[model samples]
Target chain A: MLASSSTRPRRVAGFLAKSAPAVISVGLLLVTWELYANHSGIKPTILPAPSRVLEQAILNRGALIDNAIPTIRATLLGFACSLSAAFVFSVLVDFFQPLRRALFPVFIVSQTLPLVAIAPLVVLWFGFGLAPKILLVALVTFFPMLVALVQGYEATEAEIGQMLRAMGAGRWRVFVLARLPSALPYFFAGLRISITYAVVGAIFAEYAGAAKGLGIYMLNAKNNFRPDLVLAAVAVSAVLTLVLFGLTVLLQRIAMPWERVGREPSGKGRRG
Target chain B: MSRLELRHVRKAFGGLDVLADISLSVGAGEFVSILGPSGAGKSTLFQLLTGAEHGAGEMFFDGAPLDDHGRHFAFMPQRDALMPWRRIIDNTTLGLEVQGVGRKAARARVAPLFAEFGLVGFERHFPAQLSGGMRQRAALLRTVVQERDMLLLDEPFGALDALTRAALQRWLEQMWRHHRWTALLITHDVREALYLSDRIYVLSARPARIVREIKVPLPRPRDPTAAAAPLASALEAEILDILLNPQPFKGHDDD
Candidate 1:
């Protein structure tokens, strides 16, 4: 009981340690921006204070959500496309050695061709429709997922697989049972990265061609010198990215619940 | 009355010869162990027995050619080597899943054995969630689920702490008595060898050959304590002889 009581303070301290720094950093940035906007003598339109951004958000919520829908749809669609294709393709590359030999260098080379420069061409081919934007997000998101998954699958415990084989497990069954689950952590890792890429890809494709979206809104607002609205769109984009990334984290927690048993809390480490 | 036989088994990795001219046989329900120091090719022999990698030799399981390892035996590695992604129950049922048994049927088979192995209430936990002995138990359960009468075990208790290792060895002794399965175990622990094995084969250093075979005169269901006294002394003395001064011997010698 004494030991348990003693640990409570330390446990509380540990929890605070991990989370405090990020919260503090974001808090400090908001405080600094608010101070700078109020006292730096900049016009409100050029650099809207945090308060002004909030007011603008309240005023333009409907328009923002309206413009957000198409891009969100494109992002989700592209994410799903990339996920399925990556899953199938990665399995192909892993299972067949000759195919891996033939295709891996080509994949690397494809990634090397700049996505930013490539976005306009995709927009041109698919036309200012949602298809190009979805393609762009898929293109951006596929690599990490593929790489993570393949590496994870390949890293299945060699000894255990042999043991399974001795039990008469065929190659396919061995892979499905052992390789697939082992690759999940890597899949989530890729998903976390690809989630960010999915948002950025959708925005970039939207920037290239779109009837409505935060990207188009920001561009038009910038042209009209509505920097306040542009920044507001940027903020919305950031929040959206965070939400997608957070979903990956939450999924990870669910998929790998065994990892949580002895986890140290992230509460107090960032206090300094 | 299934028996396993090895005839002139030879194995090499590229240019390095790991084992040469090995021959052995185990009758049905026999418990035999290969005892050697580290890197003495005991593990390589186990791997060859399980058809992990092909070696130049004839291996017969139950008088049938063991062309493929999956046919007549089960293998447990030096480590628990459980899949970290799978739950304990799922991991134990891997053999059946590999053999095309449906998950439901496999779980049905595994459910009864969990209580026998002291693995109740923890079926849903992953490999990383289990302790060392528990992991070892899980691996054994997986082997048991295969229901193969012949087992190839390579240092099954090598990684466990001493207390756990002793406990597990006794548990293994009990299980072997209850199951009456044929097991070919490889171990560096002399005490483990004498405690569990009916007959123990000692191998020479690198490029291992059968140096000597010691038969334990102890009775079946031998308690750890009974085996611990004379068996431990004999093992220590023989181990020192194998290491320091192994006088050249071509065949089995009791003196």
Candidate 2:
């Protein structure tokens, strides 16, 4: 306990040191942008100064928060639906080879169909409401998770399945015992990718049409020649994406606690 | 009556014959081994017994046709197939759980064997947290806890290094002596067979047929140091020669 406590600060310092380069680079870029916007003789409408964007963000914080609430709700709702739909579909594909062969290629083709193009149509069909935004987000996010789950299920060692079967396990038992657990890491990997897109997906759907959201706010701000507000909205959306991504990583750790335990340098160098 | 018997078991994958006219038997509580070179279809024999693969065969378990596949045997593969997600205790209880035993009951049943299997204090630890030898022991514990009629072990210790393999072999020998479970082991290691089994059936390469059956001329709970002794080394050399020299496949004989 004493040794670990002593090293705690050092470990934290190590982490900060490792991330220092990224932090420094981003800081430098922001500084350069701030200086350029102030002195480049460009109109504030085209590209507002960082200070103006921050000032607008603080001034219009109420509007930003209100608009953000709707977008956040749609993102969370859509992603939950996407996650369940992906899991159920992946299990079906894993169980039925014929279904996998028939549907997997179609799903792959569907991913390439440009969610941007489809968002307008979805909004047209469902109208300017929360439903279209949720549907659009679910559509855009479900495929990565589906592909991850399918591949993860396939990644189980054949001998493990054979061993399970020899123990009187039937098809469902084998799946529960071997395939599902093996797919967890892959599931999380797919989840991380999907989540990074969730807020962006929700925003894009709102861009096509929406009653109220960050995307709608940005659209209004852009039309009204308020680039500072537009930039503030982009910042808010980026922050939302980061929060969701972080949540996914946390969820992964909680779900698969064994992985963390495995990485702790076991004094016994044994792997079978 | 023998606990398990296979008569005229033959398997051919597509056009290639794997196990050609194989027959063997393990009497009650007897430890038997199928010794052969790699790709000698040694595993195919176990596969046949487990009904994982179908072939022309008559399998009898206790004077009856062995039709119920799951009831008769517990199988251990080359690698310790413990799910990385499950705790060591959970892994050991997996077979029992599959047999319709409740998790709580299964845990209660296997709780005592953890100490015996050298897995004490690792009940909650995952497979990855333990050493390779411990993991294999946990795998064996999983198989043994099921309390099946026999164990079909396909190169159970083949993946371990020489030192760990030797240690596990000695441990397994002691376990077998105590439990007297009927076990059929497949391996290319001559010494492993000589050390462990009451009888060893040597098989010819591919289209495998039983080339010879030798009764182990050693006593129970055999000393590992005795492996270097004249009698054991001589038998080992003889088995190695038989494995190295491929005899032509003669036509099937009706015994």
Candidate 3:
């Protein structure tokens, strides 16, 4: 209890230390925008003041939330599907040499097609429904995860693999016990990058064509000359990205507690 | 009967000979050391014995020709090679787990030995959490938990500092006394070989062949600090002489 109590203040201090710069910068950005629009007499349609954006967000809370539900759902479903498919593809490629040779180049080529160019095509092919949005998110997020996982699998410590093989472990058993666990850090790294892309991808897909989503809401606001509402939708998308990134970090911590334990001061001698 | 016997083992990598007509045997419950120079293929010999490399050899265990080398010997390479992600208990039981034993049963089997191996409270700790000595002990525990008939240890303490190495050498002697698993250690430290083994084989440089075999006549619980022990000094000097002067030593070759 004493240790826990003592650590609480330290935890707060650590959080402040990490977040202070970002908070200050964002605060400065808002203050500058508010002064420029309010004092300089810029029309709200061209540059909405911070207060105007906040007020408009408050007024449109119900619509914003209603649009957010579909966007969040699409992002999550796309991310989940991408993760599973990437894992299966990576494992298959790792297992079979011919498949890796055949599929790796294709994966690289697929990533080169600009998302802006493909978003419209995906909407046209899948229709302006949830399918296009989810597919767009999956396409944008899949490559990073696949590349990270394959690298992780290939990076299994040679000596450890040899040791397991000498112990009569089969190939699959070696992959499961040694390679899979070794790949986790890389996997999480990929997840952090791809998770941010997931939300943005869904928004882009919605912008191309969608029945309901934050992207559609923002598009309507823009057409109606409501800059404050568009800015409010942007804020929602930023919040969603932050939430997803934070969730990935939390999941990583929970999944690999041993990694954290090893780094703590256990009051022992130097590890090496 | 000897627990393991290697008769005229010959291994070649490409066109280069690594081990040529090497032969040795370890009696049941005996500890033997193979001492050689850095490039003398000591590790290659182990690779051959463990079936990581195919070589022309006749390997026998308990008077029977050994078919599956992996089933009969537990091996520890020079590095600790502990999986960083696995906790100590899981790493210790890795061999048993690979052999199809359930994780819980494997953990139970190794739990009692943790204290004896100086890893009592570190069962749940990861490899990076422990000190170098602790990691090595955990690795040795991993090997011992396999319950194999013999152990092939290649320079297990070579990477440790002088103090830690000496301490672990003593601990290893104690563990060997208690467990009595036939062990074959490959090392370049003459003192380590003399201090631990009942018999020592001195190998030549490249294309390693046994140059000499000396018996350690010292009694059990031998004192490593007994620099004056006549037999230990004599064996050490003889091995050093053979290592330093390789040309004349070929006269002693039985092959």
Cα lDDT for residue B117, model 2? 94
Per residue, candidate 3 scores C-alpha lDDT tens digits across B1-255 of 778888898989999999976888999899999999998899998887777888897888887898797888899989999998888899999999999999889989999998899899888788888889989999999998999989999999999999999889999987888888899999999999988899999999988888889998888787767546877788788889989988643444443
lDDT of 2 by residue, B18-92 (tens): 998888889999999999989989988878788789999788899899888999999999899889999999999
lDDT of 1 by residue, A79-156 (tens): 999999899988998888798778778778777878779988998899988899999998878877889999989888
Return the TM-score for each candidate structure.
0.90, 0.96, 0.93
DockQ of each: 0.37, 0.71, 0.65
Could you give the CAPRI-style class of model 1?
A: acceptable
- Candidate 2 per-residue C-alpha lDDT over A1-272 given as tens digits, one digit per residue, 9 for 90 to 100: 99789979998999899999999999999999999999989999999988889999999999999999999999999999989999999999898889988987887887798887899999999999889988888888888999999999999989899999898899999998899999999999998899878888999999999888999999999999999999999999999999889898999999999998899776876564
lDDT of 1 at A116: 74
Give the residue spans of candidate 3 off by over 4 A. B227-230, B248-255
**Best candidate, DockQ-wise?**
2
| Better structure of 1 and 2 per lDDT | 2
lDDT string, candidate 1, B1-255, tens digits: 538888888999998999966888888889998887799888888777676778998888777888767767888988888876678998898888877789999999999999989899889876666678888999999987888768888899998889989999999999989988888888988888888988888888878887877887777677678744675677657765775576675765332
Better model by TM-score: candidate 1 vs candidate 3:
3
Candidate 3: chain B TM-score equals: 0.96
Better of 1 and 3 by DockQ: 3
Q: What's model 3's overall lDDT?
A: 0.90
Candidate 2: clashing pairs of residues: none
